[model samples]
Target: MRRIVNITILLYVLFGVSMYIYFFTGSDIGIPVEYKGTSADPTTFMNARELVLSEEYSSVKNFLFFLGTPFEWIVLFLFMVLGVSSKFEQWAKAITSKRFVQFFIYFFYFSISMFLLIFPFRFVSYQLSKAYHISVQSFSSWMKDMTIDFWVNFIMMFVAMHVLLLLMKKSKRRWWIYAWCMTVPLTLFLTFVQPVLLDPLYHEFRPLQNKQLEERILEMAEKADIPANHVYEVNMSEKTTALNAYVTGIGSNSRIVLWDTTLEKLGENEVLFIMAHEMAHYVKKHIYWGIGLGLGVSLVGFFVVYKLVSFIQRRFGKMMRVEGKGSFAVIPLLLLLFSLFSFVISPFTNYVSRYEERQADTYAIEMTKDNESAVKAFQTLAKTGLNEVDPPMLVKIFRHTHPAIVERILFLESYDGKIDR
Candidate 1:
């Protein structure tokens, strides 16, 4: 068992190192020849310094993206293999006789431990954003946000795990199915409350201050047949220079949000194009489709986890000090397995996300009939975010949710509107 753990760690480390060298050590990739002299060229929009920064930033971000899952898997696996999880379980049991109370205690310590273990990576990521001039937040403000995030995640996980434990006690083999069933309501609740309750915790949100712009957005919404009465603007200027807009939530909780930076940086037509893109997500029902797909994937994932847990128990139960399927000590192992599964399935999920994004883009242009603004919007988005127009194929497969910036721009440049209207 010790040998196997050592091998797993070594393999993951090797994989990360090899991929980094292969992906990042090459000369900065240039725009393809087909786009070299065209408006779609990244060089046309971004200056030389900006281009260099984008490449450097993209390399680091993509490396970290590939490194993240393996590092998490390693930490979770170590907690189980090195007896840390059992120690946490024992400490929790020592303080209380009530099962739920014990679990809360155990999970609190475990979650903190995992957070600290992973904190360095998070710190590096934050520092990277600052170094690239993408984040304007101070350390104190960032830490405050982090603390809120920690507590929010803690409460949510505590409730979920408590339910899992109850289900486990009822039927060890079928607990995953029961837990899966519970996710539908949980997803709905979070979606319904997140924009109102959770989002306001980090940043202030208000009605779009520009009445004319708001009216125009509402008119676009009306044309899309969306029921939204107001456009929301988030105060992101204090936090970052990045520009963004998105449609979030379900039912009446649903709304379109734009970062104030997006409003300040882009022309009115560009902003409307972006807004139309977001509304297209709602109009096309991508939100519902995403939720359904996630639930479907989770259903399969839970079943696989069930089978894997049984196998782990039969093979290395004593070595890991986790004797039963239902024991709290098994939490780390379960997490490790889930991390591995998520890593394996990410490419597929990303593909679906990219497809949805493409559909939204097409709808945005058709609804607005403003191809020039659409092109400008994509270019500005890439510039502000320090995004490479053409990332490496591997990075696109795993990291990109939308079509490549170059692709989006070129598509907008070539699109012709229907003349009959």
Candidate 2:
């Protein structure tokens, strides 16, 4: 009864605190409490020069990301405002007849235009990685991979825009509704197809070769109620020194993948803990949860676009020559709004992802019963990945999909799973 009473009091406190934080953050001039920004300051810590360097590096990277992401959207919007979309529209008229083909033409250039705008920043990030000795791939190899990525993006964008335009043409009132409905199955299908069809375009994969480790992995998978069919290794060492592992795809395409760097660098027990974490992701059915959540978010985003886009187009449409919903050029306006909405909504998305990651971390610690190994694996990961042990709170709220490495290790150290030995 005492324990129950204490728990009730604790719950009330937590609820009150959460409400306070939400209210504090929900307004136009709401506190940017997360941006206090001193957590990553090197002067704050003792003993570890590595942590200082890592945090400094992360700060630069984060700044680059902040500058680059919004810059693209701003540039695209500026082009439309400056009447570049009209010029592109004339080119599309000269080139193609089928509405689908015309959209493909517009988006091919549209996608590449964004890519070109962002490429210099990406290259700078690449140079930073090389300076840090994290990335190992040569410029030629990187360009090759990026070229493939470009084509893939172009195709995906074309199909998505074509379909969206079709939906709008048929029912402007209900297009967002139809588009929101389509997101669920499409996301699932891509998740199913990615491991089998798409992953090979970037990396080499093979069945994990160490028979002893493979046996242990299979045993762990069985214990975790996973399929235990395959453990695949990706040659990530060819690109970067980062140690990583993940369970990706679903159903037939579901597989556990380990980076070759992870295999080379981590011990067998550490590998098992990591694999257990990946298995936890599958067992939790986080993919379907993500799909459902994304569908809902997409629905909300589409509704917002539906409500506000026409007003925007009407006010600026004649100047840009992008009149009406059926105009192929409407795609750019849609993307602009979607990008802004995504930026605005990022904190909520990151919150859910971080929750799922923490759940998987707890499940991993319990399933492995090797708290030391799990902690050690995360330590190795943090070191290899150059993760900031204590990132800025704004980074956590806005961009981080997982909890900080320090918090993860601390949680493992304090966890009391107490499963029978």
Candidate 3:
């Protein structure tokens, strides 16, 4: 068992370090010569200092991003291997007779332990963003936000894990199928409520103060056959310099939310083009499709997890102090397995995301018929966020949800704007 743990740790470290060196070591490779003088050019959009800062930021961000999963896996594995998870479980059981109370108590300990163990990586990442002026939030504000994040995540995880364990206890052999069934509606419920209930906790949202832009956005929504009555603006400038806009929620709860930074940075038509892109997601039902794809993956994922977990329990249950298939101490092992599975499947999920984003971009161009504004919108996003307009292929595979900025801009530049009627 020690040999297995040691070997796993070594493999994780080697893979994480090697990938960081391979993809994020040097300066961004940059776009082709044809884009050099164009608005899409990174060199022209940002000064040399900003360019260097972007590279440094990307390297650190990618390092943290890539290492995060492995670190969590190791932590969870160690908790199980070192008997810490069993200790936590024992401690919780000693405190309560009620199973639900015991579960919550154990979960709180597990969640906080993991949070503290993983916090330094997050702190370093946040500090670097602040140092590079990417994040303008003060340390106090950041801490507050972190606290909010912790509680929100804790509550959500508590609910999900409680249900999962309940299902496991009821049907040890069929728990994964039962859990997957529960997960589908839970996911949809979160998506439906997030824009209204959760989002307002982090940022102040209001009707777009610029009534004219709001009117125009509503008009666009009307033209797109969307039921939106208002366009919302979030004060993201308070936290970061990043520009963003998106569609969120479903049915009556649906909203078009623009970051204040986007409104401040771009022109009316550029904003309109961005809005059109967001609206495309609604018109095309990308959110529902994304949910379907995710649930479909989760169905398969849960089954794989069930098989792997059962194999682990049969092989090493005594070593980990996991009593049986129904033991709550097994949660750490379940988490470790799920984390590994998510990392393995991320490339496929991101590929689908990129495809959807490209579709939205095309839809935006067709609806607005203003290729210049579309190009400038992407260019502005790249400059404001210090985004890599043309990242390496590996980064695109794992990290990128949208097409590279340069690709979007070049597409817009070359578009003939003949709408398909």
Candidate 4:
């Protein structure tokens, strides 16, 4: 019976992954490369406002792009229903009945199972990236980074689940509220330490090497009243060809970081525009506001979960071998619920993000007073990143965090601000 169950689980995983790739990833279909506007603004961007990719290229990218959190939720559900988590708990009990030791053992067994189950998706995604020349790193180097990422995520999951499960064991009804409360401080702590501690484990970082450019960026930061001590540069070129920049951490820990690739590939004007966008996030207090909004939504989510989880536990716990929220066996069920909640709330979350992203774009345009620079920077980013210039409304509402590239460029071109320096 046990062997049959194991085989069933294996088949389910194999079949599910294949179907997921086929339906959600995308098929081999031709994609048209057409720009909407006929008139080219030579002052704005060289290519007018358009995104062009080969039919094969689009398929490969879309193929690798697993649809959001559903895949994750499905994998978690399978892991639970197959009694994988329970089996791990049983194995750990043979080693030692100690709750502390069991949690650690359970963490590895469950985490490794989840990781391995998702490994094919990761492997295929990386393979496609390399095939497309977007990822430059060798296979061995990629695996090392993946290992580091796994451990970092392991620690985070352990901390969060440990607190929640402990609370669950103590009080049935109030644990969700307490867990939500705990996340406020925990989330901030992780955010504060991420740039300082965790990020270095995966990539090397240094202060910007070009003193002239660094000084100019600092000047803009001063104008924006952004209190960054040093503009940092990360060695992202070692891994991928993608361009990215962001502000991370908070208060004493806050810093604006640019990818080394940005320096290598972009002109100095474009770099300043990018810096202005990141600085706007800090100057506008988007980071803190984001945290506040997250906590507020979390409070609501936890309340909903509090009502629903017990009902689930009461109805299906014994049959599924997931006794309650406190049981390790319940992890998969909880993940299913969390994934559903996240997916339902995603549109609202993305709406907020898109709004903030537009604000940053506007701020960059106003601060730099160089619409040309902002537009060109985004063009470069879209070219490198293969961003959709004008996504449909559904994509924007459900997934995209930023305004479409064409929309941003058009907004910049039409804005009434001029910088006088």
Give each model's clash number.
0, 0, 0, 0
TM-score for each prediction? 0.96, 0.86, 0.95, 0.87
Sorted by TM-score, highest first, which candidate order results?
A: 1, 3, 4, 2
- Local accuracy of candidate 4 as per-residue lDDT tens digits, 293-385: 889988989888777778877886666678744677776776678768877898999889888998888888888888777777877776676
The model with the greatest TM-score is 1
- For model 4, state the Cα shift of residue 55 in Å: 5.5
| Model 3 spans > 4 angstroms off | 1-5, 24-28, 33-35, 418-421
lDDT of 2 at 235: 93
Considering only N, C-alpha and C atoms within 3 Å, which residue pairs clash in candidate 3?
none
lDDT of each: 0.87, 0.78, 0.87, 0.76
Worst ten-residue run, lDDT, model 4? 35-44
Better of 1 and 4 by TM-score: 1
Task: Give the distance in Å from residue 250's predicted Cα in candidate 3 to where it truly belongs.
Answer: 0.5
lDDT of 2: 0.78
Residue pairs clashing, model 4: none
Candidate 3 global TM-score: 0.95
Best by lDDT: 1
Summarize candidate 2's per-residue lDDT along 15-109 as a digit string, tens digits. 54554443333322212344233322222332376665565567667666766666666666656665666667668878978766677777777
